[model samples]
Target: MPEDAPERVEGHTTRRVLVTGAASGLGAALTAAFRARGDEVLATDVVSTPLDHRDGPVEHREHDVLRLDVTSDDDWAAALATVEERWGGLDILVNNAGVAGGGRIDVAGLDEWEWITGINLFGVVRGCRTFVPMLKRQRSGQIVNVASLAGLVHPAGMASYNAVKAGVVALTETLGHELAPYDVGASVVCPSYFRTNLMDSLRGADEALGGVVTALVETSPFTADEIAAAVLAGLDAGEEVILPDPAARAAWELKQTDRAAYVDQMRRQAARLDQLA
Candidate 1:
């Protein structure tokens, strides 16, 4: 363990978790998981309303979502205030609000780059900046940043998306060290494609590449709830980097153990993407 690793608490202690992008997908799954474990969750999203999924309305529960645009500092501040007023201080901060975009480096426009970065990367930054001080003051908290497999094992035709997710990975790692002395822990969740409405936020100059990603997401055997369960288990085990799926674990292991084979596979994928484009 690292020198700054926080000591694990014993026994069941209810935590107050604030999850962004909790309107649906992995975020909603996380919210539900924590609540099921007898923790309090303040779910926030770009929309403040009753939670609804693609399948149907969320089952009637005492669910109230706050409106929080992660890109906005004012919104983040408001969230902090609300947390203080309601929960005294937050125990876990889940920076999971992100949009997806991918294309060839030359094909993706700067506008597309900015839009995705604002939500995917900087959104997490803003959340940390706003809440880290409070966490440090209290000397206890955890941060979970939701990244993607692209962050760890980058393929082709996703330059912007890869860069931002990789940034999240770097940020989370750095925080793990920086906040360790304060009795705080940080984890980065890098799950591969699963059945999620993440495609709803997909935007790219290359429509074909978008379609390819959509298919991968739609066809994945894993579900958001499954991924959420894995995340909680990883946290329980004091893991800093959580690879929630077997594919993610395998790809990361391949990259770590055999550089030559990983490079060859990435090259092959790039060539295939070129053919599709």
Candidate 2:
């Protein structure tokens, strides 16, 4: 242990955690967050790049990086086997693997739609489906699926992204209800926007409108580490909808109070996209 590192909580049990998309973004940030709190983390990304964990809890682990594809059954099985063999049990799974894709829904082709849905939506679906049994058998575990505010607020140009994340939100909500009886926790994250690499994977997006989205993201008052901390706090408190920022929280309230009003407001905001040209 580092001399200056914060001490682990007294009597705190170390949790065995698996995080997808662990190479970067929320995954990498949250992996460090879990490790900082003395939790054992299995960080997986489809890309096999070695993680730069030179000085963290996972720095001295037997393996710091595990290659697992969120969209592949073989990969999920292999990852579970590795976890089973190493830890003999699992405690936390953060299904954070996803891609960003958007444009006008009318012009967004089937190929891009499939590509985004495959990675963003189906990827989360596979993670939940594959890990639910383990969690059920243990009768206690946490599943955190990362959705987006786009799911709750349907803006223009993000039709597919909205659909996928909304599906995640709904699926995880239902899963939470099902897991309540077993004492397992389920949560869906609906963060508005933070600084992350999600923008790097955008597909079929209009350049002018993309600039608007990028501006909003970059100018947002939140950071990825902040989001990660929010995730940890939310999970620790057993919160179902983990809205990481004030913007997301307020929007959530609006949607809950009046769906038609929220939709009208979103339609008004999305009208700007048409003027972007």
Q: Report the number of the highest-lDDT candidate.
A: 1
**All candidates' lDDT scores?**
0.89, 0.83
lDDT string, candidate 1, 1-277, tens digits = 4342223345668898999998889998898788777677888889655463343466523334688999999999999998999888989999998898989988999999999999999999999998999999999999999999999999888999999999999999999999999999999999999998888888878877887889999999999999999999999999999999998999999999999999999999888888887
Error of 2 at 88 (Å): 1.0
User: Each model's TM-score?
Assistant: 0.93, 0.91
TM-score of 1: 0.93
TM-score of 2: 0.91
Highest TM-score model number: 1
| Residue runs of model 2 more than 4 Å from their true location after superposition | 1-7, 50-62, 258-261
- Residue 120 in candidate 1 has what lDDT? 97
* Candidate 1, position 157, lDDT: 88
Residues 66-103, model 2: lDDT tens digits: 89888899998888889889888789999998988777
**Residue 169, model 1: Cα distance from true site in angstroms:** 0.5
